[model samples]
Target: MHINALKSLVMDAVDELKGQDVVTLDVSRLTSVTDLMLVVSGTSSRHVAALADNVVEKAKQQGIKPLGVEGRTGSEWVLVDLGDLVVHLMQVETRQTYDLERLWSDFPSDIHEVRHGEQA
Candidate 1:
């Protein structure tokens, strides 16, 4: 799937499940690992897991298979890797603890805070 379309699909899925504090980082110029990174927060462990599942399901519906999924066992944070996009679904506390936004934003890049699937 195209990057933008995949981004929309992922964002929509997160919005559908009410993922909190959605943030999209354009890392294409910063890294070759993936073009974009989406960091989302969930209310709890279950919410985090569900968000990851939803992203995977939505991608599959569009014929996009994820490269990998991690952190489902604990559910505090779940990551869905979709080649061009990598999604981080984490519990609020975990998100604060790791502070991915600050970590990645340290470098020069476009950081967009997304709310309800729209840039905030």
Candidate 2:
């Protein structure tokens, strides 16, 4: 699929697992590593793992392959790397500690917040 469509598909996959506090950041200008960074919170490690797994599965079902997946061992923070999109699934505590949103917050215009099945 096209990049935008792929991005929406990935976001949709994240939503499927009911991930909380979902946010999509357009980091394409800051880094070529990925075009979009999707951050989400899960209630627990198990939920984090499930969310990551489900996203990978769902993406693959649509013929989209991720470059890599990391942090499955701890599940405290799981990352799914698609070429143009990187997904971060974290527990609330871990997410707070890392403060990715804050670290990347400089690019406010790049952010698109989605939570509770609605956009902010």
Candidate 3:
């Protein structure tokens, strides 16, 4: 699927589960591993795991198999890799600790907060 479509699929999945503090970072130039990074915060570990599962389920329904899934055992921070886009599902504290947004702050990229399922 196209990057934009994939991105929307992720956003919708996250929104379906009411993920908080949704953020999207364009990292195509910063890294070749993935074009976009979506950071979503969940209330707890279970919430994080559910968010990741929803993303994976939605992707599969669309015939886009995920390359890999990580952090399922811990459920603190689960990452769903969909080739062009990587979805990061984390608890509030975990997200604050790693701070992916600030980690990539120095780079010239399009970073925006998503509110109410609307792209900023």
Candidate 4:
């Protein structure tokens, strides 16, 4: 699937799991690592893991498998590498500590304050 469509699917999956602070960063100009970075926050470790799992499953349904997934065991921060779209599912604390948004501040971002029960 196209990168933008993949991104939307991933975000929808996370939204289904009640993910918050959903942010998408366009990293096309910054580096060749990936085209987009999706960062989302979960309430707890289990929540984060669930969010990540949902995203992975949804992506797989669309015939897209992540290149790799990291930090699932701990669930403090889970990273799903989707070649051109890397997804980050993290607990609020870890997210704050890492401050990935700030680290990649140069990239244009679309921040969505996800509200529960709302359609993504």
Candidate 5:
């Protein structure tokens, strides 16, 4: 699938899981590590885990397998690596503390603000 399509799929999955603060960063120019960076927030540890699981399952259904997953056991900050894409699911507090947005401020990204009642 195309990179943007894959990105939309991932975002859809995150939306299905009711993830908050979902943002998609176009890191193609900033780094060679990945084409895109998806950042999402979960209400708590369990919520984060659940969101990650949902994303994994959704990706599988779409025929995209994650290369690996990290931080699942603790669920503080789960990172799903999909080679071309990297997804980060974390608790609000953890996300705030890590401040990934600030960390990767140089990268050009499209910020999609998810309103509470809007469709994901």
Candidate 6:
């Protein structure tokens, strides 16, 4: 699927689920496998799992299947790979621990703090 279309679908799913600190980073220049990385924090483990599942279901509904899913065991952090778009659904603790956002800080990441606004 087109990057923008996939982005829209993922954003909608996360927003509908009330995912917090939703952010999208363009990692095309730094990563070889994927072009975009979307990160969001769920209120709890169950919420994290549901958020990931929602994204998967919505993508499948739109004829887009995930390449793979990870971290469903404890549901602390779930990573969904959709070829060009990789999504990270994490609990607040997990998100802070990994800090993927800070890891890719050199890039001009368009942090979607307001659902539709630029980085803060």
Q: Which residue runs of candidate 4 sit more than 4 Å off their true CA positions?
A: 106-120
Q: lDDT of model 4 at residue 117?
A: 41
Query: What is the C-alpha lDDT profile of model 5 across 13-46, one tens digit per residue?
Result: 8888789988766666677898778889999899
Instruction: Give stretches of model 3 more than 4 Å off.
Output: 108-120
Overall local distance difference test of candidate 3: 0.89
Better candidate by TM-score, 3 or 6: 3
Clashes of each: 0, 0, 0, 0, 0, 0
TM-score, every prediction: 0.90, 0.87, 0.90, 0.86, 0.85, 0.89
Better of 4 and 5 by TM-score: 4
Q: Model 6 over residues 1-120: C-alpha lDDT tens digits?
A: 789999989999999999888888777777699888888999999999999999999999999989999999999999999999999999999999988888787456543223345643
lDDT of 2 by residue, 7-114 (tens): 778778878888888877767777778877889999999999999999999889998888899999999999999888889999999999998877876664555444
| Decoy 2 TM-score against native | 0.87
Flag clash pairs in model 4: none
Off by over 4 Å in 2: 107-120
In terms of lDDT, which candidate is stronger, 3 or 5?
Answer: 3
Candidate 4 displacement at residue 25 in angstroms: 0.9
Candidate 3 lowest-lDDT run of ten: 110-119
Candidate 3 lDDT, 43-77, residue by residue in tens: 99999999999999999999999999999998999
Pairs that collide in candidate 6 are none
lDDT (Cα, tens digit) per residue for candidate 1, span 1-120: 788899889989999999988888777888899988899999989899999999999999999999999999999989999999999999999999999878887886665444444644
Minimum summed lDDT over a 10-residue window in model 4 is located at 109-118
Candidate models: Cα lDDT each = 0.89, 0.85, 0.89, 0.84, 0.83, 0.87
Worst 10 residues of 2 by lDDT: 108-117
Using TM-score as the measure, name the better of candidate 4 and candidate 6: 6
